[model samples]
Target chain A: MHALSLPTWWIHVASVLEWMLAMVAVIRWGERRGETEWRWLALAMLPALVSAMAACTWHLFDNPIELQGLVVFQAGTTLLGNVALAAAAWTLLPERSQS
Target chain B: MTVVGLGALAAVDPSPLFVLSLLPYLAFLRWAAASKRFPPLALRGFQFTLVFVAVTIAAAVVAELRFGQQLADVDRLHGSAEAFLTVANLLVLWGFSRAEPGQEPPDPEASTTGPSGEQVLSTGVEPAVPPEDGASVLDPE
Candidate 1:
């Protein structure tokens, strides 16, 4: 195969790191509003963390059925995380007076 | 990342199952775009998603052309695809983090009551107070 294994490994590593950074950034952005907002961000991040873990561990599975399950799980996590993020953003509306 | 690869691996080819796995993320992207809370961010996200998907497909095609239809080669392409998409996501997050959403200030002039605050809103008239003597209150007809 033209695709080398080592470069592929680096790419996966980078992907994980990028996902972590994105989660942190999302949390910090939400936290600027208040603790409640921060909590929402934290909640949103859980699925993403799970998805990342799946991505990291996917290679261990040799069974086709198991791989399919992981794929479904990944899609679910990404969807849940993104929806949570959107909801969190809506919660942190611009220019609401602080209670 | 793993999802995309495993999705492709589930099938012999990379297109059908991988696209299926990616559908949810695409749906989320569209929803976020329509949300209008962060128009620029939403736009950038759309652009990045398109790029990520396009690059992934192109890479998979190139690998198939070069190395025949092998699982390892497809997996490698999936890794690169994931890496690209992850970078795009990170960029989107960075832009989002830089944003400062201001809180809406309460409008002082907009009184809760009508122009004059003395009128009792519920009854649509001034409130009646009884005096100490056996005085008749405002007995309306």
Candidate 2:
């Protein structure tokens, strides 16, 4: 198995940071909208955070090529996480006026 | 093959297609924000599409990882991330469309009517009655 590159590890770290920022933003948006559902959206980010951490660890310490499968899995999970976040955003954001 | 096409393009450059894939998601978000009537079905459809794309891209990546040597030209990794995000945006659109509006406040002036004739009579103020049909209350003409 090939060793993981520095870029791969960096990407994982970046993803974690991005997700964290998004989580905070979503929560704040939810509060402004008086939406209680934002909690669920924030909670959804946890899995992606965990996955990113795991993937980063695997890439940095383990065989990167073999870790490809795990990376793909985490990416898929992140997709779902993003969807949930989006849902919360929509729910909490003000709707456009019909007029 | 479709994969070959993706690979060939990726070999030459991967950024353009990756950006293209993201366009749909961005468009979806814009539409959802601007739209007035958020239908539930459309939202679900969008979500399903995103999840589908995400799964497909992930599968493609796994395939590439297993056969990376053969498809060395393909930037499967980058493509997968783009596809995942695109699909995620679609899901957001779906959820937005499905969201229901909050309950509206009750209308005023629905419950109370002005003081009736009997009440006015009790108060010693004469109540003016309107003419019925063509007949005038003030004059018979």
Candidate 3:
């Protein structure tokens, strides 16, 4: 396993921080607007956070390739993120009226 | 191996910036849907085309910086494709925005009624009734 570079660690840290801030912002905005959809969408940040954490662990352990556990976790997180984004969009946007 | 392949081919290869650019359209769609107000599809399409042109120019600059003068053909093609896709995405977004029902304007008759006994005296109309019982007289019942 190769050693982790400082730049790589910085990127991971930044990604984690960015996602965390996004989660907080979404949740706060949802609460202020009384939007349940936005609140649910905030949950999407969890996966991003998880992926960031796993990446951090991998770097710390000097593992270049992600473990299977990490991959599955991140995949699930990505899927949730997509679903949450779609749902939030649906709730926030106008819907077509059925005749 | 398959995972990396999927990430690169499915996710990373196509300019992530392109997808990011779609965020505005997605936001517009969401807002339009939630508000139950649909704008004209053609107007939306025009706006999208403008954005597409802007993004294409930006992409051309980036390609030039990365590829230098060696890949002029590639740069041009990349810009063209980016512009096409941006326009295409804009069309799709416009369609989505127009999918919702548009709000109708308020009825003119509903807005003409004034509070109290004062009749909305129109031009050339005589004050046919006294002001005290004007509302009761005007009432359909």
User: Which residue ranges in model 2 land beyond 4 Å of their true spot?
Assistant: A64-99, B1-141
Docking class of 1: incorrect
Tens-digit lDDT track for model 3 on A1-99? 234345444444544554565566556544433335556555644654675465456446554333434444444554455455545555544332221
Best by lDDT: 1
TM-score of each: 0.55, 0.38, 0.39
Q: What is the per-residue lDDT of model 1 for residues B7-41, given as tens digits with 9 covering 90 to 100?
A: 66455533354465465556545544544444365
Docking class of 2: incorrect
lDDT of 3 at B111: 24
Give Cα distance to truth, residue B112, candidate 2, Å: 22
- Which whole-number lDDT from 0 to 100 does residue B103 have in model 2? 14
Name the best candidate (by DockQ). Answer: 1
Positional deviation of B30 in candidate 1, in angstroms? 3.5
TM-score of chain A of each: 0.66, 0.59, 0.70
Q: For every model in order, what is the number of clashing pairs?
A: 5, 1, 7
Error of 3 at A46 (Å): 1.8
